[model samples]
Target: MKSGWMRGIIILLVFVLGLSIGYFLPDRKEKMDVPVASVGDEIITELMWLNQLKEDYGEQVLQDMIDRKVVFSEANRLGITVSDKEIEQEIQKMRKAYENDEQFLNSLKEQSGTTLEQLKEDMRYYLTWEKLATKDVVVSDPEIEEYYNNNLYLFQEPEKVHAWQIVVSTEEEAKQVIRELEEGTDFSTLAKERSMDLLTANQGGDLGFISLNDSYFDPSFLEVAFSLKEGEISSPIPVEKGFVILKVTEKVKERIIPLDEVKDTIRKEIALSQVPSLPQVLDQLRKQAKAQILINDNGK
Candidate 1:
């Protein structure tokens, strides 16, 4: 579960309750006028469901709320703060892993049980605490070199190709272009004049370098690109939007990423890993602040 969260980048643990700012919501007695579920003559009302959820998970949710408050206050005391633009930038980078903003939100709802607003709020706190925790953290060059040597597999590169393309609406059109190429017509000239792909049409159909894992292009197109030898032009291959004629410009062998490029990332990992877990850090801060919780045993 922890690994899943790490991969998904979904950190909010508390679910549906995250959407609302207040944990202990006021009575919705008027809205409970209708039945949520009915069994013969008996009915479970909306208020009942809400009450059950609160009774079952309220304590944990309240604790999460407390931790958030503690972290934010501690950050403020230390004159540490994160701006909306920084948060948005991080969110945009993460969102690139998804198809679009809508899909990102849907994934969040399904995985972390949080909305966009709640995610922003939680992210601010998490960043605050992370900054506070790692303020004095240091990772040496030796440590980075050691980690890079031991974890070379993690940097292994996938197959990649550098290719050019001219996309057309029909296989016949693509084949006609291939024939033109065979008859000594320049691919880039024809691509600039007639290719239907707007983005690359003016650039002489240069798709640049791409790998199998690149989300921008179709897997089938990438497969055909990599299969072609350097300087070989492909037969028309059908894709989602249209048929494409490809020219293989270059081929790259799989290789590990260099250590110097990933030094900062490795340093962050080593530093954060050395510190107490976020929860533990928050607990320590709460203790320092002498924060208290009052639970009414009279069945709140």
Candidate 2:
């Protein structure tokens, strides 16, 4: 019986492997013949172009394909060449990233309609253009500093408050609670006994630290709560249904950290902002280089 069970398991494994390979192999084979676009003597097939599209824009796959071909033509004109060894290394990195999941790797291969080898070649072309852009674009430290100064408000931390609240349905009940609190009633005990906010009533109505812009509480409540000094309690603030009395347990000042602490982040942002000029540089290179394009469906 054990021997029969082992045989069955082996057969099942073989069947699954066969199905997976069969499903992925057709897409890979089609990728070899698929015509994407042409750059000079290089013919990028439909499979190669679609794979590039999937990496960048999954929704508008065809547009990405056209854009990639345009970029590739520009890269070739600029003499931005990627070596086979570089492509191999990228493929190895991808394989490592998906090492734990064989199924995921297989699905990626099928979805791309290209084998792992072809994907690496596509990646090589993409990286070569990226490297060229990085090396050629000029963004100075002064520019970064200027951007930082202009956007200082974007980095300011808003004031935050931590407080406890008690919501009572009736004005008389609210007044009675205030009177009891004046007579030394425990706020937490009173909240647990009478407050209607089920989530925090047991924890003495502790609402935790909330930002001034928090949408949960009413604007009137926030206005009064923010104005109160720490440890000060507010008078019953009228709401839609009842009244809310709050104690300002804690208050944190808005903080703006120094730019020096984030200089590297600022520099990267500055560099990225200069990327649009790369294609123009590539265009100049194309004017100086020899290129050819052959379209199979010229009339279309």
Candidate 3:
């Protein structure tokens, strides 16, 4: 019965292996005789291009394909699965490191050469492997509490303000804007119409949430911004280009995030620390599965 079960698994693995190879294989619609590129009438045929790729990258590419298959098989054996929602949550976690979603997507494409859909699939595979690797690892509540206590600095939020601005070329123009604002002319409307800072003007001079440590805003500008209470507007302040009016929309005081807020994150970190290195886990899984390499660079 065990031998029969092994045979079934091997068959499934072979099918998956073929699919992996097909992903890297050249398109069937393009004939091997077709020219892939030309340098002054010296044509590089599709067949030649494929042959070169096979010789140069075949071994490593094949190894990677096998590794992916092994990870999938092991994950299946262990009944571990990565849900789409989990993948999305992981992506959201990564996105926090970037300025915005578009910026994150652009960076991902430039740095990893992958689309969002491709990244989702990659995340699925990765999350699956991570689960398999850390299945037995556990983080106690005390460990989480200790980690939180030791890493208090990591959880602190600096004082920040959500602010807007209306920049003008001269102090007189800035003062005029302040007068209009005082008379109940909407600040955002004035910003859109009169602000000289073209970048934020259309968006009603929104600077978003900013901290003193941001370094993007001038020290003078930051000082004026931080001095204002929420809903208070600053008088004309001199900056590099011209005079500017500032409004503080919201203020967040510096505070350490509570242990309850970061406990799940700390738990994951502690559990991850207990898992073996990824390569070590993969090697052990491969050995247990009795994986073999049937082809080399020579394709024999």
Find the 10 residues in a row with the least total lDDT in model 2: 1-10
Q: Considering TM-score, which of the candidate structures 1 and 2 is the better prediction for this target?
A: 1
lDDT of 2 at 50: 41
lDDT of 2 by residue, 1-300 (tens): 112222333333333344344447876555455565788999887456444433443323333334456667766777777788767655554553331234335645455544444455457655665656665567677887887889998667778887788889988888888888878888888888888876567678777766778787788888998998998777888888688778888899888857885665576566656676646645544454433333322211
lDDT of 3 by residue, 1-300 (tens): 112222333333444454335546676424555787999969997666666666665665566667779999888887898888888887887775553456667776666556677677667777777778888988889889989888899998899888889999999888888999999999899999999987678778887777877777788788889999999999999988899999999999988999987887787777778888877988998898888789754688
State the local distance difference test value for candidate 3: 0.76
| Top of the candidates by lDDT | 3
Q: Is candidate 1 or candidate 3 better by TM-score?
A: 3
Q: Candidate 1, overall lDDT?
A: 0.75
Candidate 1: deviation at residue 237, Å?
7.5
> Each candidate: what lDDT?
0.75, 0.63, 0.76
Q: Lowest summed lDDT over 10 consecutive residues: which window, candidate 1?
A: 1-10
**TM-score per candidate, in order?**
0.57, 0.40, 0.67
Model 3, 197: alpha-carbon shift in Å? 9.8
Quality of model 2 by C-alpha lDDT: 0.63
Candidate 1, position 44, lDDT: 91
Top TM-score prediction, candidate number = 3
Mark the regions of model 3 whose C-alpha exceeds 4 Å error after superposition.
1-32, 45-52, 161-210, 215-250
